[model samples]
Target: MKYTFYLKKTLSFFLFIPFLFFSCKKECKLSPAECHVYENSGSDCTKTKEKNAPVVASLKEIIHPISGSDPTLNMEELSAIGDYIGSAYFVGLGEATHGTREFFQMKDRLFRYLVQNHGFKVMGFEATWGGALYVNQYVLQGIGTAKKTVRKMKFWTWETEEVIALVEWMRAYNLAHPDEEPLQFYGFDMQSVDEEYFWIKDYLSDLDLDLFNSIDTLLKPYVSVADYQTYPSLSETRKNKFKADLVKAKKLFENKESNLVALSSQQEYDLIHQAFVIFIQNEDILDPKFGKGRDFYMARNSEWIRNYVQPRTKVALWAHNGHVTKGDFWAEGAELYEAHAGNYKVIGFSFSKGSFQAYQPKGVGLTTNNVVEEMDCQTVNALMADVGEDNYYIIFDELESTSAAYKYFHKKNPFFMLGSVFYPDSQNTFISLVNLPEHYDILIYFKESHFAKPY
Candidate 1:
């Protein structure tokens, strides 16, 4: 059950930052006004006809301190963020999967800032909930004794460094604050016994033993005591019916290919979805003692936030940038955040090279070692000329920009479009879905020039 790393490539240049470096190199500079475009823009400049347009408000941007300097945030900024402590916030890690030095450094800084300044006590991630609980329990018993055992276990689709670092951080935090309640780390993704069975095997040993015994009993009815090994053969009519049904189930499971290896993508998706649905509906058949399953977990997560954190504590979730982004797949019609309503504030953190350039107006003289551009309405197009022609840009007018349209189409929920499957509904069906309003209160986009570069 151990998690494995599939290293895609070596570290990139952007990920070369050292932990001790208090600030970034001055390779380039932009005016404070230029750096904070949304803040400076008046109503006329910021307003757009798009319903998904970002809601902006002025807040001071913190500049990283110089070499050997301690990072600091002004009181006003700290107070503003503190006010939303009980609310859920989804913070995106910039270039996290790349496992670069800068990514680690930024993550550490953000973690410390949130804990010390923002009063966050819980840290949830994209990891498996049961596996995380197991790791925490093992670490609490003793790291020296538990390290090897913990390494052997697997949970979610995450790198070893990511989970190890998170667990270590929690362990260290608990050690330092002995009197405080231990901070919780959990996962929210729907669970499957096939996926999580390894984590709960010890607890269900007796159940497994009983089920095997029952299966042995059930098999006796179809076999004779004298020749059980050869069992009873089905009559020709029964055999045909069995084969026909098996073929039907196979077709439903595989979707198209006559052979097993070439299943359609939709078939794979349906298989995964069905596995989740079964786990949610049949907890009694799987875990007799607990009688808890997928639906219970999902409801618990929503209830925990609504009843516990939403009332008294602020929580932040570290997940994929897509989940936290205001209109992305994880945010569309997300019921968790809607439960909190006005009490919660979600913010997204993303990086985009284009966003920096987008700040420059139609015409202006821009000079950098990378390129030089003269002011004009087509500045963005001219600046990106060196980039390959196939590099596509997300033009707002080219697609539906509102969250509702994006979610309704991409998630393929018939309810979203009044049960219609044609015209605008079908046409926009390819758009990405997002967890509705709970996604983000602010989005940070970090842009780079090459697609191969770390995002």
Candidate 2:
């Protein structure tokens, strides 16, 4: 949720500026009063007498050791995850750092496992909703090359060789399952509106030229915003007018909903309506006066996908650990989804140390750097390292209540939560503190991480 990378370089950063300036600074230290209570709840972080002994012993028992993160490997080791998923509707797969090779590969691997075993039909990303539709076109219809489509999604974090591999795999899967419904890929985040706006104009133009012109004229003034730095300088009256125009656009969509659905499929009409909603969300989050953050709308956009866009289909969300955790930091929206969806499960990733790609400090551009070797006995990464497995995953809910691992999870621990931007020396600033049991249902840990190979 750090606004330092996406919009900082282009058009996506403005919406999350508030998050970078405000939420990113929040950290739960080893303070006595806040050591381990479940973030919103008052449950105590109980300590065990044996320190790491019992926890390590229990971890050794429950952890599912994997051969590697490679998706092509015999994935029989990942079969246990299906049992942990049970009947969950949404599986939020999170990455410790957006640019880690193994994390991306692991997610690509896990998603393949889920689709094959669990009948998961949809996958959503933390990307611009309208833009990712093209990627979906590549997956479902093979409309373009995977590398070019992935690059067009516009998030530098996702422009990687690992992701290209995933897209290629998805396309292959669809080809193999000729009789079945093909897998669906989409972006749930509503940070930018240019793609949505352009699509809407084209969609409406096909349906009704007058409607398209009216809506386009209403939205034209705001669409030219090329950067985040300029939006804050707009006068209040102008901002209010922009907000009003967005509402008018939505009303126009609503007034002709039945006709629109008649001309297009219900699904197409719904997508058009959602595009307007995203435009409003992009406007609201970027507006300095609005209190709602990008995560707030992101949660809603994700729900919209689950409930309407791809109704009755199991969805796997791909995002950063900060956006997926049910903990309080930048999780206001994820918490909302957990409450409403009820069957949501989050899987968080971690690494002991390595290098990752991130935008250079102050948003100069992309660079890869090794993380400083920082570790603490109380942190989750160190505890997982104590287990001595190069790669393993643990499902917290599967552990017995009396087990040392369960008690260890009950306590708050520092987690490696790097985003798309990094300051190697300022590790403490990005590593967040959270009760693992409350924030994530499953934890995947790798002993070392490497930078994602760029395509």
Candidate that would win on TM-score? 2
Please provide, for model 1 over 321-345, each residue's C-alpha lDDT reduced to its tens digit, 9 standing for 90 to 100: 4443334323411334454455444
Q: For candidate 2, lDDT tens digit of each residue in 1-455? A: 11112112111110011111111114434332222111212222234224676788888998889988998877688877888787787888899888888999999998998898888877889988988877877777677788877766789888888988988898899789877666777898776787887778777888888888888888877888623676768888878888898899889879998988787656667767888998888888788477487888777877787765346778888999888887654573365555655578889998876667776565546765434243444567766887889999988888899987788788787665778876644556665677887878888998977778786
- Name the regions of candidate 1 deviating beyond 4 angstroms: 1-80, 83-108, 143-157, 160-163, 191-195, 206-278, 281-314, 325-333, 353-439, 445-455
Instruction: Look at candidate 2 and tell me the lDDT of residue 438.
Output: 81
- Global local distance difference test of model 2: 0.74
Question: Who wins the lDDT comparison?
Answer: 2
TM-score for predicted model 1 compared with the true structure: 0.43
- Each model's lDDT comes to 0.33, 0.74
lDDT, residue 289, model 1: 39
Q: Which ten residues in a row have the lowest lDDT in candidate 2?
A: 13-22
